[model samples]
Target: MKRKDYALEAKRFVDAAGGKENIESYLHCVTRLRLNVIDKTKVNEAEIKDSPLAKGINWTQNQLQIILGTGVVEAVYAEVQKIMEVSNASMDEKLDNSKLEDFKLQVKANKETLRNKSWFFGEIQKGMRVLGDIFVPIIPAIVAAGLAMGVSALLKQILNPSGEQLNSLLWIIVDIVTKTAFDSLAVLVCWSTVKRFGGNPVLGIIIGLMLVNPLLPNKGSIAAYNAQLDFYNNQLIEGLSKNEIYKAWVEAGLKWIGQAPTFDANGNVITNAVMGDPITAIKVWIIPITGYQGSVLPALIIGVAVAYLEKWIKIWMPKAVNIIFTPFLTITIAFLVALFIFGPILLMVEQGILIATKAILGIKYGFGTAIIAGVLQGIVITGCHQVLQGLEMQLVIDGSLPGANGAAATGSIFNAIWTASIISQGGAAMAIAVKAKDKSDKELGFSAAISTLFGITEPAIFGTNLPKIKPFIYASIGGFFGGLFAGILNVTCPGMGVTVIPGLLLYTGNWTKLLGIIGVNIISFGVAFLLTLFLFKDGIQSKKTKLGLKFEQLKNKIKLDKFKIKRKSAE
Candidate 1:
């Protein structure tokens, strides 16, 4: 491959996209530079596609995405950011002489565009966009953690096939990587959410740390330990349930400020009317606020409110006292709101989703599983699939999913479905490679197919399948059937992350599950390949058919005109 100048490419991209002023915001995923532009007309699409640096361009979700291959995107993005910063600085210097009213008007217009519409569905769209912005940046971390979990499971399986304990230092190291990444996920979510919502991320980190504080009772350990505690006076006493313990501790600490729960007839505690006010209710409800261990929803809710509150405080407080009061008030108010209101509500919502998912997967005959598996990729495309990671992590910790019996074992039904759904993408890409008429298209198809096998499908989806509608449809069909089979087999891996080729490690000790996964991949690939090859044809073939029909029609029309002229001459 010839070496290309990334700086020049970055400059070309900026220039073609109508310079810094036209850009609203920009971010990058694994393989694309996604930019939200103020004016689509200002973008020079032809120039961007013709540029050697860009692999492709897509305009969707109100953003212009320039496809730059992985590993190079980071460098290109850095260069682009640098160019934009320089351009902004120069603009600022020039704007010193510009009218202030124009700047104010521009700001006002931008704010209006940013404001959420009153329509409920429109607000939902905005919420989804916010989630995508916040979560996309954190996906790499989650993926890394999931891979680590898989690796740890694989190592344990290899060293201890009988599920015996391993005292190896290497196991400890592997375990650390898995635990630290998945266990502290709430912190990452909080940090990302705060930044996305325009609040100080440091405050978010503090809140997250408070939620997962080591002093709080661990939900997993409390259940087992509660059984070991002694009963007093025929009543459970001296036992630390996760909720009861935290609530009692908080009441004890705030004894001077609020009243504790009062006992009623039959020694049952009256929770609702405790202390004759909502303060007692808030204090007693503190337990659910602790250990946001596998949760992102709570962080998101808290961040959204906190961002507004922070802004409000800045507006009201005097500049001299703002430094002293802003952080104090922001933290105090946000934490209270999170603990008293949003925490319980969001936790219930989270629990509801978990129960709903479990119920769906628990259905006999695999009907529900098949439905979920079929649409898993569609969910992924909309970016809602990232939310499932929290559920998967919870499953890993609980060891609830089937085939996840061993101490080191961890898995989720979501992981199995995702794996099944992804392989079909590769299969479709392979078929395209074989059927493509253009050499460049064929090469891209081959590359995308290989990339998808390793669990990266953006290249395949964007580069090949999406551009050709029929191929994508064929691939989706393949995914559906493959997912259905996975559901029927009740296939489960020991961990999340790194599907397809790298996912083999997650099923190391479970032969049946491993075979099931292999079957799913084979079926998906074979079905997609056959469907694309036999049922779908290359774009060139379709074009040729259209051209042939047009030629025939033109020929017949000329013959008819000639006959008319002959008749006239004869007369």
Candidate 2:
């Protein structure tokens, strides 16, 4: 149905239920309509069941629950909220000051108080946090350098096939862009993570370069020195800065003292350090560092400390930590975890996966690629399916992984289901549209028909066919068979982000792949329709027609004339 019509029809159902005054509390969890009502006696249960607005209703003590299929619940909730004020009711009949009453008052007072915060800011933060958890650790070197390599490959294919093309004038620019772009993926992740964590992102970005820093001079030299910076004669040295020296001093002092330490340097250490070489100078100045270690490893170590500390703080000072503190704590915790744990773990996993792939499937790259893409796609899409689609685009753009062959394969499987679902429901929708005794079913049929064609099956699934459960099972079974066949056939697809149908052209160039795609679509749809027809009763074949009632007269008798809208002005 059109959005407005759906809203209107839902409102009709609400108006039928004693116009919202009968409802005590309203809530939706996952799928079903969970409600608490004031006067159960006043509800017309038979009217609702016969009206076609609800598939079924069940009364379980305090709750009045209704079933509307997926995608339709949001519209129902939105319409009901407009017509009524559903508040939580206290269970304790004797309690003078109930928690439910207090919560109701709080909700009334705090309407739009929290959500007035910027949506864009929240979305950006959420996106960045997701990236930090999934991408930031391995991003610094692998993705950055890989993208650069992709460009280099493209350039090499086009302009530098052999050694002869390298001397060309354009090669210099291509070489620089490709080389630099490849390694910047990690840097981007670092900066984005720091930015999300409320740090000076510019500093975070610059610091990320330490991974590829030329200043270290030798491999793992900084780690070998335990990141100790040496100064000479109380003057600044070339390798270590004044800040580095200060940090080293603080760390050394902290080690000597159990608690946080302070430095007293005006007389003894300063005077002794002025006359020595870098080693002697550092020795005279060193004070066995204590608590705060600001180096990367130490920051990570402290971050682990902070995680445990925050838990205590939360309980110790509950009033001080509310929703407002969530962002701050999240940032701090993420910063430490990313630096210490996530970075190393992600790097190791990514490296191992890449190395293993190269070793085992370097020759049959296509087959290996398809299996990874198809399997992961299936698993990821089961819950909030869109996440895999988003990740596929990111990985491809980052260039560490090959293009989205896995994504395409998985999407194709899902798409087969979508198409089959629409076709299977077509007969049912037509039946309801043709011979339903109630005007409501005819209207619902019109909606189910359109929604199914566009790959939305909720209305048909929940409203007409799916409550029976047989159609849904059949659709999924057909989809699995069709999807598996497509995979085994090596139906290669041109990269089209995630949506499978959009990449149909990728298979167009090859007749075998094209034929396979067509075959899968046909099989899935045909099987679904046949199963649905056999399992479900035909809605269109009316006994009233055979009983000598004229079609137009029957339709006219059930025709909907006008809708009744409730007046909030009276309330």
Candidate 3:
């Protein structure tokens, strides 16, 4: 639905959730506002779900997650906070107090029922929530930067070839805009992580900057240099010899990253294989000083450790000396430990994960990638999708490198997989909308379906498809088929973070890949739509309930009683 006033809608949600007093704390992710309430039963979920503003609602443990799509969720979250602040002074508040005793009784039964959920999965979900807290806040920034880079790449392709006057000037400006976010990604991660853990935001920013200081060797550059050297040294190129064909090409740009080796004890130059000949061993930095640029794991670990340490520092230190000593101790201790201890350990772990992911997704036939494509949405459903955040970001970082077009197209393949799954769920919702006999069901399904095309899928999943099990299964099948084709075609994108229709921008340089993802969209949507329409009867809805009428109808009953009292006096 097109929005009314956001503040008024926030009031509706707040009122439906018993009252402002029932809420304890709340936070928002990309497409949902997760609120922790003192009393779960006080939340009139039916009213909230039926609201024109809400796409759906679900609970993970005690936290109520309301899916409001992407653009609206943030606005509504802000308004809700505002509502909480002003609610006390408002004499006209419409909170219904009639359900108080019933709510208390229901709260007990709700607790007993909630305990049936698996304790193991609950703990795992809690960890995933922490990951969500760290990553989801920066999602908008990443998406914006990724799209900016997409535009820059398009500008470079179109204007660079023609030697237009605007080419270099425009490209330089856009390049600067695009590179800043990913170039300082570790800093963002640290900042988000510390904020998630309840530490001071300023300290988080300081620690993050320390992790990515300009004085240190550039991490991404060194990795690129090493990766190229390893590929040449291993002689893995089949049917073509790099010695004869690539020696000149290699010398064109690869000569400056390392230096000649020192002589060994016997006065012989240390040598290693290069291409067809042996050369003096490449002397690189022995004592590493590289800063993590596009890394997430190192910053994540350091953020957690420092957050707790800062809390500890405050426990015993005299408040008198705290002003002088706190900042000094935190910065110095975090800097040294990050460099010498946590940094190395976490980097090694990050390297292992990166290598393993590349090996699996980079398999010869794209079989491994195809499997990931088919099942990733299932992972999303489990709320374990947060676990893949590192993998997905690494893919985008690797795929955006200069030579990735000639590589296996890892980023694009993973993106296509993601896009396929997202849109398939949307297609299923669309099918339900199209075939529904009830007007309310059609409205619900249509709203959810349309949001998914913009790359938000939780509404379609939670509000429509998952409640109807067959549609969810059919959607996954559609994704599998679409992703299988995407894998075979080796579709490529410059980056990730956007998908479906808007995602088309990522492939603007290549017509064939663009057409290929278009094919993915059509196939995934078509299959899911066809299956859901033909097989599912009556479409997606509860038989008796009207989503948006519940709360309003309840309020109307109170108005009717007051009117009856007024009429008796008039008679």
**Which candidate should be chosen as best, given TM-score against the real structure?**
1
Stronger candidate by TM-score (2 vs 3): 3
After superposing candidate 1, which stretches have Cα over 4 Å from the reference?
1-16, 29-34, 44-58, 66-132, 216-287, 350-364, 368-571
For every candidate in turn, the CA RMSD to the true structure comes to 15.0, 21.4, 12.3
* Candidate 3 structure quality by residue, lDDT tens digits, 1-571: 3334888888888888767767766778767787767555467888898778788876644567778877889899988977776644463344444444444444544444334434554454455456656766775565466556655545543444321334367667876898788667678878888877767768888988987787665544555455445544443453335442233223222232333334579966565324332222122343234566665667777888778888889888899998788777887898888776655554455465555655767765656565666566765643234335445544554454334356644444677888888889989989988987545457667877776676766557655676556678788888877887788888766555567876776676789989989998998888889998887654213311331233236335443223221123544
Which tens-of-lDDT digit does each residue in 14-46 have in candidate 2?
Answer: 655544644655655323454555434345667
Screening candidate 1 with a backbone cut-off below 3 angstroms (N, C-alpha, C), the clashing residue pairs are: 410-494
- Best of the two (1, 2) by lDDT: 1
Query: Residues 265-316, candidate 1, lDDT per residue (tens digit)?
Result: 8977665222212211123734554345555556667667777788899998
Q: Using Cα atoms with residue i matched to residue i, what is each candidate's TM-score against the true structure? A: 0.53, 0.31, 0.51
Model 2 accuracy (lDDT, Cα): 0.41
Q: How close is candidate 2 to the true structure, as a TM-score?
A: 0.31
Determine which window of 10 residues in candidate 3 has minimal summed lDDT: 539-548
What lDDT does each candidate get? 0.62, 0.41, 0.64
Instruction: Pick the lDDT winner.
Output: 3
User: What TM-score does structure 1 among the candidates reach?
Assistant: 0.53
